[model samples]
Target chain A: MNKCHITNEIRKFRFLQSEMTQQELAEKVGVTRQTIVAIENEKYSPTLELAFKIARIFNASLEDVFTYNA
Target chain B: MYRKEKMILASLLATIAVFAVYSLYVYQHYVVPKPEIIHDFSFWGKSFLFLALVMVAAQIIVHIVFAIINKIVTKKDIPVISDEMDKIIELKSLRVSHLIFAGGTFLAIGSQAFGIQQWIMFAKLFSSGFIVTILSDITRISLYRKGL
Candidate 1:
């Protein structure tokens, strides 16, 4: 539980997408901007539902948004 | 940002403040001797009365705040402090709090056994308990934010 489980490529995606703001993504995905910030910082693992929502927003698969590193 | 948490924090602060003020009143006016005419049994009675009042007042304030916050943020059912992630964080914090509490309590016992000042030992226990509780509360909030 203390270990950081999920890793992601969100930073690369944000850069690829015209340096998109976290709040814009969060608003599209129906979550608070802080949630997006937390995800980007790796300080939080998005819920399964939020994970899917993010992948959808990025037009990518779940593995594109998040993955279990260990 | 959630109303319920703000409400609860406010209640905790209010309760602690009210009791603290009442304690100040007792200590200043009644417990110690002063130059003027001494206070009477009423002060003793009042102290006891306010102690009870403090407890009751704290409980009532907590409930009232919860109710108001609930109504104000009616769309969100209950607070956001509880969830699978928060539950995990709470469990971790409780473990840390328990360890500190036990260790501090043991140190107090050891000091008394070695004949260090008893008042100091008591103070150690009191202070550690306060620290542990505050630490636990903070950990819970941090977990809520960080989703650990």
Candidate 2:
């Protein structure tokens, strides 16, 4: 089944932000490293609050970070 | 996976394994014939209660020991923080668990309607509950591993 319709550029953003590690992002966002991995891979979609947090960390807008395909 | 989630899954799997071995032993020794079990309901009930107690006690002790050892090694207290993704994963896993449990219960009731023995019904209910709980933990662990 197609579970997630949302995709993200977390990896690219993380790289642009001085190559932030998954653990670093996770710590900053108060989540686990695994969650970042999942979000980057598009296997899981983050809530609006978490999405905003990630975008804020990278100094990017929500649209620049994530895209919803239908 | 989150550290606390991993710990919980490990503990639950270990407890289920222990219970499986113990139940096998009990079945072999105490539940040889149908009539014998009927003659001593307390034996079955007491054994189940004791095993449940053991499982709970063992889980607590194991978690405590794990925490102490982790503290000693890391020298810092690890805090588990759950975010929105964690909560969503938890809810998804819970939905799956509830469906499995409800199906098992309906099956048990159906068996009773078909004139299945009371002992079998009880066993079905008990084992289904245990197995589904383990499956739920496994689901959570896998979701954390591969994503939800």
Candidate 3:
């Protein structure tokens, strides 16, 4: 299977936003900290709704948060 | 870790342990004896009954223990939330586990070509379902920990 590289700037964004912790982001986004870790490390791709929620938390656009590289 | 995931892991372990013990009993009593009437309905019925009883007991025990632990250790109401990634992980693990059932069924059919004993073939077919379940739970746990 061809792996499409879907990367995120969540860690970067989190740090820029007053060094927000993963737990805080997870709580604000209604997800678990492990999920935040997964997204930051590119282990799992967040759903569209979750991606939007996360971007909203970081006060950034969805495109600014996640990039899809084919 | 999510309490539900931990509960699943505990339940799966208990189930597998029960199944292992049951497998040993079946091997000794049914396979070793090689009864003349391979289609002994009573024998098979009792075996299934025992397995079902063990599974029910294991589930009850695991839930009680989990409840106690939840009350004692956490002292907080844990929310059970299923996220999108969790669903994806479940789908992936289930898809892989289904392969085990498919392969086991194929192998069971192939065993006929080898003139394998009917009782042994039946046992293989029966155990395959449980094995698939155990493997699926293990896969789900692993994916949760390591990422899907």
Candidate 4:
């Protein structure tokens, strides 16, 4: 939580995917939509399972969705 | 299940449980068809039977509702609970219950050591114990939800 990290591009991916609702993605990925929002805002970090889920949904590598600042 | 949906379902089940207990009380007291064995039954023993029934009914209802909802909502079966974050929060909540259990037992002993005249009766002791565990669990859950 302390180390710097760039937030997820989930919102952008979500928008690109014909405006997928948070709830829809949450259902697909098996997490609460609130968790999706938290990850987007960088307020919370997703578990490895969820991070992989997001990457899968976006059809991108983990690096595409997330990055470390330092 | 979605967390919010789980919460709503839990709240509904809790409300139903209270109603079920009240219904049983009324039936056992004034509204029942007739007492099976009127004079021979111990009142406390009858109450204990009703309490057990309520507990069993509540458990059944919770499972039934969760199963039904999950079936209706999705083809994929999601656990009522999921994942490590949830497990951690649940474990923390359970810890509060243990703390309250220990504290209440200690307090009861302390009162006896002070030479209090009356014993903590079974009903009072049971109610106190129940309240401590449940209150602690609920408060702890709320704290965890709020990021404590």
Strongest candidate by DockQ: 2
| lDDT tens readout by residue for model 2, B1-148 | 4565657676877778878887887777777655467346577578779888878887888788778877897685656677777787789878988998898889888898888876776677677778777887787777777676
Write model 3 residue lDDT over B14-98, tens digit each, in one string. 8888888887877687768885545785776788788888889888998888888887898955555767777887897789778
**Count of clashes, each model:** 0, 0, 0, 0
lDDT of 4 by residue, A5-69 (tens): 65678888889999999878877888656556656767556777878888998899998888767
Give candidate 3 misplaced runs (Cα > 4 Å): A1-4, A16-19, B1-5, B25-39
Candidates, ranked, TM-score: 2, 3, 4, 1
Please, what are the lDDT tens digits per residue for candidate 1 over residues B1-148? Answer: 5443455466556556765777677667755655222235344456556666676777687777677667776754443334434455669889989999999999988897787866556547655765675677666666656556
Provide per-model DockQ scores.
Answer: 0.21, 0.54, 0.42, 0.15
lDDT of 4 by residue, B1-148 (tens): 3444465447455645664666467557743665443323254356546665765677577767766776787764544446444555567767777777777767766677777633343334445555654565466446434432
Q: Which residue pairs clash in candidate 4?
A: none
Preferred candidate (DockQ higher): 3 or 4: 3
Model no. 3, DockQ: 0.42
Q: Which stretch of 10 consecutive residues in model 4 chain A shows the poorest summed lDDT?
A: A1-10
**Model 2 / residue B9 / CA error / Å:** 4.9
Candidate 4: count the clashes. 0
**Alpha-carbon lDDT of model 4:** 0.62
Ranking by lDDT: 3, 2, 1, 4
Instruction: Please report, in order, the local distance difference test score of every candidate based on alpha carbons.
Output: 0.68, 0.80, 0.81, 0.62
List of chain A TM-scores, every candidate: 0.88, 0.94, 0.92, 0.86
Model 2 docking grade: medium
lDDT of 2 at B146: 68
- Position B16, candidate 2: lDDT: 82
Predicted structure with the largest lDDT when compared to the true one: 3
